[model samples]
Target chain A: MLDVTKAKIIHDFAHDRPLLACRYDPKERFVVTSSEDYRLQKFSLPGGEKTILPEAHNSWVHALGLSPDGQILYSGGCDGKLVFWNIADAEVKPLRTLDAHQGWLRTLSVSPDGSLVATGGNDKTVKVWNTQTGELVKQWQGHAKNVYSVQFMPDGKRILSGDLGGAVQLRSLDADDIKGNFEAKPLHTYEGGQMVDFGGVRCLAVRPSSDQFAAGGLHKATNPLGAVHEPLALRFAFEGNQLLKSHVSEGITGGGLWRVQWLSDGTLMGVSGGSSGGFLIFWNDQQDKDFSKFKLPALARDMDLSTNGLNVVTAHHDGHVRITRLSES
Target chain B: MKCPYACGSTEHLMARRKFLSLSASGAVGVAGGLGLLTRGAAAEQVQQKQQRIVVFNMHGGLSQLESWDPKPGTRTGGPFRAIPTSVPGLHISELLPYTAQQMHHLCLFRGVNTSEDDHGKGAYMMMTGRRQTPAADYPEIGAVAAKTLMPEDSSLPGHIRVVPHGGGGRGSDAAYLGPKYSSIHLGNGNPPQYTKRPDGITDEAERRRQEFRRKSDRRFLDGRRTAMTDVFTYSFEQADRLMEQRDVFDVTKEPTQDQEKYGTHDFGRHCLLARRLIERGISFVQVSHSNYDTHNENFDFHLEQVGEFDRPFATFVADLAERGLLDQTLIVVLSEFGRTPNINLYLGRDHWSKAWSVLAGGAKLARGAVLGATNAEGTEVVDIQVDHAQLFHTYLQAVGVDTSASFQIDGRELPIADPSAEPIWTAIA
Candidate 1:
């Protein structure tokens, strides 16, 4: 009898350690997480009150990006560093730490006119930088492993990344061009499973209005490191980039799909649970029905659809910082 | 032959007593001289400094009438009452007066039995000590201690999961230890900015771009090698030792009188950043404190959830025993199965997994006392029972690990604590 109602725990940041990647703040009123205790915090959304940037970064802060003019914030760490914060006065300082990569910066992409950023690491290289001049503007270096999702393609001159060999590559923010048009790609590529068998291409989203995208795999060398043969994909994009309708959502027999979003009325919201009852679902706009679910209290990793679309922040794996409420009807 | 020249000051005092009898007969040969400064002050008064597991996940199950198997004056013990603690026969539930003044460092474990009363298989059998596989997928003991203690090199992150969302059954993994032994998830820890350094960038261009990416990664590894050459040379030496200790996640360099004794909450600044990430060595950290799937009001919702766990858990166990760090830190509260020794009809309690309770104290557990028991109709475990592989071998023998170790998988040889249950070693200490 509860579709989604009790909202008032606001922000329970417990983490003796288990919060991996979370982002929000294009006005969802602050929420940023990434840990294994190397730190990167900032929470206020719906009054969870926490503001200790802890000097922003040094390690383990893997992937974060908010600058669509939310006044800068881009992190990506595990000491391949790369920080760029300034969320206004609560500043823990770090306009640039760019250790640039030898490994572990894993994925970040910002450029819907925030003036370029891009990043991807475990050092197979994919940087771009320049967020209004902290420099290091171009460097793509064809992935051979470790790139794990990057995206800019809302047409800021293309860029999509996804590696560790599941291949998604697209590049070209031009520095006199450096190879990576690998032919109008990732309109769809879900061959994840075996080939070194660790399952890569973990996440990718793109659908604020619709070119209709979504990708998530994760199964890094089995036993359960985020397993997935195909946990979620959606595709869509018509007219020459081809790939009209692709859908894929029923294979969730036990925790796998890392993340996938798309809700602006085009509706697609997501969150795949694990350890058995991790729901959140949403889907409408007929992506094959099933328009509701809420049960979660664990493992909901990365969700955001609130520039006032009636909040939905989420970033879990037991760090519990939810917001919920996309629609009741 | 010595007798012939014997007069040179008695052969230089018999060669200075044979060089002081060969330096006291090589006393275990310089075991690092002076016994390594008295074994580094006897491992600094018995090696402690690494203990972190702040779970507290009361996610959706809260009634033994109100807390701790209470049966009160019976009729299925609804209204709540039972008080008294600090240890004498451990009473509990005057709606937990600050956990009855820290019940002598809590142990509880009121005999929890299980059958998965659904919250998705009872929160995936209480955060993955195991059960819920349909083919692979088992990695949640904080993703197996973030795949056994996170430091394969350490750019910090051998397992961290604050505000975690899914770490139970299908996937909350680092399972066969990939995704580089996963876990570094914070999608939310109040506002640690998803892990920080998103914009203000200035530790001198983050230490001159980490000394220009360690001189362009030593000139691009001067002649590469692949298959992730030892995971890219141990992730570039843990990304240059996590870019020179990124100020150990700087809680504003602490001391606003220790952030007002960690109680302004967001789970008390994630338990004071999990005691500064286990005093900076990070082996496994898991600050969950979630929704507690409460089915209904259930005694004014546990009198405001047991006063939000009695003052941030008695100020995070007296701030880890005033920084000596609670005998190596273990903490644990736990919940995903407990509630309803009958109360329902809408007052709510529901999901009872046979018997329920789990409190656990710091690292070397077995402290003070209490192991298992239940009866007086709390439901089951009539005596000693403990499951979840004996609570993951009593949390791997309270940290000294070695639950028979092993690992290999898919070709056999498992162990790493699962040897089909054993470690209740009376709760180990």
Candidate 2:
């Protein structure tokens, strides 16, 4: 068994405000953090040297996506603008800007080939853009609420988008349309009877093999406004959109999981927190038992896995970026 | 001096007391020119005019940051941005896009410092314009409007509440203003209960039954006078009147195009019903939108609730203007308080009353006026802090009520508004 409790925080980068989104470069030598201070900072791993993009976005940046090659960075902000940046030799350069969304852009996902980027936004839209050209390729509108998370399937032929109403849609990319315009079909939805009106699917992770995906968010909604609720992860089979299994972290209750990631070894991890504090939970599909969990210092807003698959970095609401080592027992 | 309406006998004294109670209720001279000696000539003139008030109560403390007083780009501003409205240089939250377009008919009060915080207490304070007190129960603004502005000859209930059962805070009772002024509670988007005859009961049979009951009640009250019995008698009469005009509460009578414009949700339908009831001469209508107490996922819930509220409210306001009722109707958008500017660990906002906002307009209120101001973080009132009582006073004043007038209850006279409070003069035309 791998014990996360023994994981040590190797480095902590502090900012003036909460860091909302973060990404690890493919080389695993650089990390980019987006903050509420409206700046994006690129920090050299291990060295702690930082390069700041002061005017990265007009408002708070909530989402960031790194190209498959890791040379390009894309950020979406509350200003409804998406900007592309080129990171080379520990320096940041502004490349292009797309006034794509009408409202706050929530999440961004880049294709494996780095040809396209899909964005989910508060405007209830899932938009696809050409990664190289800053042009909006396709706009799909089926979600009745804010689309919180979007991910491109490993095959790159389909995109999965989840919304605040606990609805998920699988949209197939049209090969014939050069503009990337495609129809979105309802693939799967899971309300879990947890007040679909309030909570949503916050995070989605696709397996490396592209056979299945896991979604993490709140279930078992409560009253008194913000009272503790269970954080859940539902794993679905990619082909049939069948719900294969659900893993709920027992005894760890409060807010919904904000981020979910599938480790190279097929282990699933989720980070969540509420009034009490933050928590890191781990689950393996083969195990029928409870998840292994660890407490954190603050609410985790975003997380990224190192390219080496040995360390996990989390951006916290307390303005600390925590890097934790992961190893097998 | 002997009472002109009654002789100097014990029964006559009781009858005179009833007249005093009627005058104290503020309903006696609402439509007539019967000027009481206690009322100033100007106050009498104000009371003689017919006006209406419709309070759109966002039940949970709506975040000021997401509505009327947006501080976009601030650290505490959350994920939403500010959008410019019809009034140049004035911006509200982007979530209220529809309301933004109708800002010319609204006056925004961004610096309300109501000190109460708990749901029940805060709701009481906002509804009554006074803090919760064990000493006495004060009437809500709707009840006061019903008592002071409702025409005596009008068949419709003066104060109508469109809310889900057990919603709308502690229920808008008349309190000391007496039962006659209490709100006629209607189900959310549905008519008041029992307004229609029972399934098996014919209308003729129902009328005959009511007539028989009135005769029996008269005999039961033979030569005896009590406020409790009078309330019962008044309730029966009001029920009869409501039954006669039940169609006023039927929103289905509205055209499908109009209903579609309202968006078809419960809150939307309730707003549509409110407009219909107001058109039928109801003096005060309160429509409540629920589930704004978003301590968890504040942004998501606000997007849903505010989105649900925006279009219908804008459509309602615009519809009133097109019907020429805007000049006579005062529209109020309020809540018990506001949510905290500081997003909590759950990414939600908690109850915050230290600084908040309320929106009022129409009935000749200054259009495109943004009164008062909050600090950049929206944490405190930096200028022209208006409290609950002051807001209540403004609502009454906007609808042509005399704030200086007093309501006499139990021989104790009380000013209609808190004496220490004053209306926001900048908001008044």
TM-score list, all predictions? 0.24, 0.90
Q: CAPRI verdict on model 2? A: acceptable
- What does the lDDT come to for candidate 1? 0.59
Q: On residues A1-329, what C-alpha lDDT tens digit does candidate 1 reach at each position?
A: 12333322234555434466777787667777774446667787566677757654544565888888678888887557788888644655676676878646877878888888888886677888888777887887777766777877777776777764566666567654443422213222322221012335656666755355555543312322122223344454523444443344454444444566665556555666554435566555455533455556776656655565656666665666676665453
lDDT of candidates 1 onward, in order: 0.59, 0.77
Q: How accurate locally is residue B140 in candidate 2, as Cα lDDT from 0 to 100? A: 92
TM-score of chain A of each: 0.32, 0.88
* CA-RMSD of model 1: 27.8
DockQ scores for all the models shown? 0.01, 0.42
How many clashes would you count in candidate 2? 0
Q: Single out the weakest 10-residue window by summed lDDT for candidate 2 chain B.
A: B30-39
